[model samples]
Target: MASFDVESLFTNVPLHETTELIVNNLNISHLDKFGLDKVHFRKLLGITAHHSVFCFDDCLYTQTDGVAMGPPLGPSYANAFLCHHEQDWLEQCPLEFKPLHYRRYIDDTFLLFKHPSHVNLFLDYLNSKHPSIKFSCEMQKDNQLPFLDTMVTNNNGIFHTTKERLAWEPRLTIGSMREPTPFHEARLVSGANSFGRHCQWVTGLQVLRSQSLRCSHLDFVRNTGKRTIIERHRATRC
Candidate 1:
């Protein structure tokens, strides 16, 4: 398995060109779901897309090319554009090197190749598809790599999930129980679900050749228990 990240996805994708491609290729009959006609839909897409904007470091300047980051719409639009572009590569890929499992989250992608011998050639072909969108891949280390919030591992031929060591830890609760927000409740439930999923994954899987657990597993259990039990006590008091 090989994984890659699209470098500066939002800032590099050509917004106008992507929008035009989307508008031109969109199915006209499906426009009613958005309560819009072809012309209106095109206008809305174009209007909402980012254009030139002033940025000042020491002095003022205008940024051209890709959409500016920060706005919620920027990632959604960029992901759509990139996804469309990537489909072309997939369609044209040779059968011997086709990915067995392809998963993507926005700009990050994980690809599993049936024949490991062809991985390098396949990775090069993927990068060659588009000049602007370049992918940097993580070569498999001990048949394992991080993908999203999980560490995906291949033991012999089977796949297993391990926890990802992120820069910041995940929260068990968003706020105090006295805050009277639904987020606290939602977070508690989410935390429990995450714990259950973790336990399920590691039941029969070994982390390393000599060990069954890692620092992440210990941290996950400790932090999750501490937060949830404390949050539960607070909820009972309220």
Candidate 2:
């Protein structure tokens, strides 16, 4: 078991390239029915993708490098961009070197890549795909791998998970700033996506919240988004 996190993901996506890729990949038949041809759709996407401006720390900044992080379209656009590259990579990747499973939620990726010597090689290949995108990996140590807020242990083909406390979270609690954040703050770190081309994986789940959640929310699991039961079971097919 291992995990890879894209370093500064949103800020590094190539806006023009991704917009072209997305428009090209969209179904032309459906687009035509809506009076949106490939060229027109590409133009619209290009304008929206490039027109991001935000102010932080009282300084106005125009993001000239990549997608802005906070917009509604940021996650979807970045995900589509990644899917394009990943599909192209897997087509030519060697079977032995390929991972048994690959799961990604936005910028964070978790996979079962067993080859010890080839893990670095895989990271090197991913970094080579684009100049701006890079992956930092954590291989399993003592049968444990930390992915985002979850610690996962894979025994045989089964998996178990427990929430992890990040070192930085403690620093955020300083100076008696103990007031609970608004419920909508949860959306800031939201996305659930999993993919396994030909892998049977199992997982357990437990959901914990820092403060009482304001919404009547659905349950969630770490490795797979569906099936909230905390017992070994096959992950839902994507």
Residue range 11-85, candidate 2, lDDT tens digits: 888998887767666666656555666786665554455756443443334477598876566876677678778
TM-score of each: 0.63, 0.63
What is candidate 1's lDDT per residue for 1-41, written digit by digit as tens?
88778888888888777767666666655555445565765
Worst 10 residues of 1 by lDDT: 174-183
What is the model-wide C-alpha lDDT for candidate 1? 0.60
* Structural RMSD, model 1: 20.2
Clashing pairs in 2: none
Residue 84's C-alpha lDDT in candidate 2?
Answer: 73
The Cα RMSD in angstroms, rounded to one decimal, for candidate 2 relative to the true structure is 19.4
Kindly report which residue pairs in candidate 1 clash with one another. none
Count clashes in each candidate, considering only residues at least 3 apart in sequence or on different chains: 0, 0
